[model samples]
Target: MAAETSFANASRRPRPLTLVAIVLLHLAAIYGLARAFAPDAVASVEDSVLSTITVTVETKQFEPPPPPEPEPEPDAGEQGNEGRKAVPREVVAPEPRIVVKPAPPAPKASSTGAADTSGARDQGTGTGAGGTGTGTGSGNGGSGQGGGVATKPEWIGGRINNARDYPIPPGGRQARVGTEVVVKVTVGTDGRASDCSVFRPSPDAEADAITCRLVVQRLRFRPATDAAGNPVAAPFYWRQRWF
Candidate 1:
């Protein structure tokens, strides 16, 4: 009974070879199951394990580039000065000049035989009482009836009384052969007839009136000058006779 009990305990303890063989048989069965399911089941288990694992990546910060430098300013004596503004200059005007002229000298006076001291001239055709100048003078004791130099006015176109220009009275009013008309006309400084009047009337009044009208219309004179040679208004005498 003691030996049987010892044998029964040994049997219950399990043999080493049988345990090894059973472990090998279980491994073979697992290998066979893996082959049956193929590589699909193995890949799914690897993907599950890899998906559960977490990976961390670090990011680096980048800095910006530096700013560009500014350009230098040009000097005053540089060629760029041609574009600069120019300073203004002051201007001056010249002074005006003045001039003066001298007056003319007085005319010389004529002397006679007795050497009269008076400054007047003698213009009479006949003998005078007393005069300093020549032309039919006989007086030496007193001042003569002489005055300043005088000149008669002359017609601008020609001598008056030309029959064609100054015709006789119309309608033959004057039957007399010796019909005459005389007029006195005043000439202005501008050599124009300013006024006229009949000095001597003809037999016919129409003849006398026509003489003065024609004188003013057709006559213009070189105005008479005084002793000083300046133009002066003077009287002019004209006569017209009809045959």
Candidate 2:
């Protein structure tokens, strides 16, 4: 019975060395599992911490200094007449001078002679009366004669009648045959008519122009005369009947 009790106690109470070996084996298994998963856990923690963390930089700025104030100007009233002074001057008078002039001399008188009356008494009786009457008659005859008078311009009738055949104006034949055109002709000092203008115009402009041309070509005149009988240029007018 004692031996059986001893065997039972030995089974119930394990050996210290075996218990130590089991704890060593369990510790070794836990160390191997921690070694295998530590790298992945450390990598995952580093990724989360790096991804969630942020860094901010602050910058500082300096402000500019204020501007300087301008200096004030000087007052005008305080320095108005600081260095000015008045000076005195003297007045001088000029001396007067006198001048003299001579007077003109008077004219001298002339002498007169006496008259004789012995011949004057003899002529006053009868002989002087007949001589005075003959002198009066001669003076009256000289006063009656006068100077020559000046005359006006005169038209040459024969020359004007000869110039009746004037040129027929353009379209003049179609117009009424009895159209009278009057023109003023300026006669030069040489007795030729120049610068003729139509005094009376026809219905046709060409006829009026041609009439002036014909008058200047065909007409002639005796120029006017001055009071001294000098021939001068004058204007005269005449009429022509269109055929």
Q: Residues 1-243, candidate 1: write the lDDT tens digits.
A: 999999899879868998999999999999779868787887788779755643221111112243387587443221111122222223222333752543332223433322223334334333222333233333335466444336656666643444433333454324634666667788788888867887767677765676677777777788888777878787777776655
lDDT of each: 0.57, 0.52
Q: Which candidate is the best by lDDT?
A: 1
Kindly report the root-mean-square deviation of model 1 from the true structure over all alpha carbons: 63.0
Q: Which candidate comes out best when scored by TM-score?
A: 1
Candidate 1, pairs of clashing residues: none
All predictions: root-mean-square deviation over Cα? 63.0, 56.7
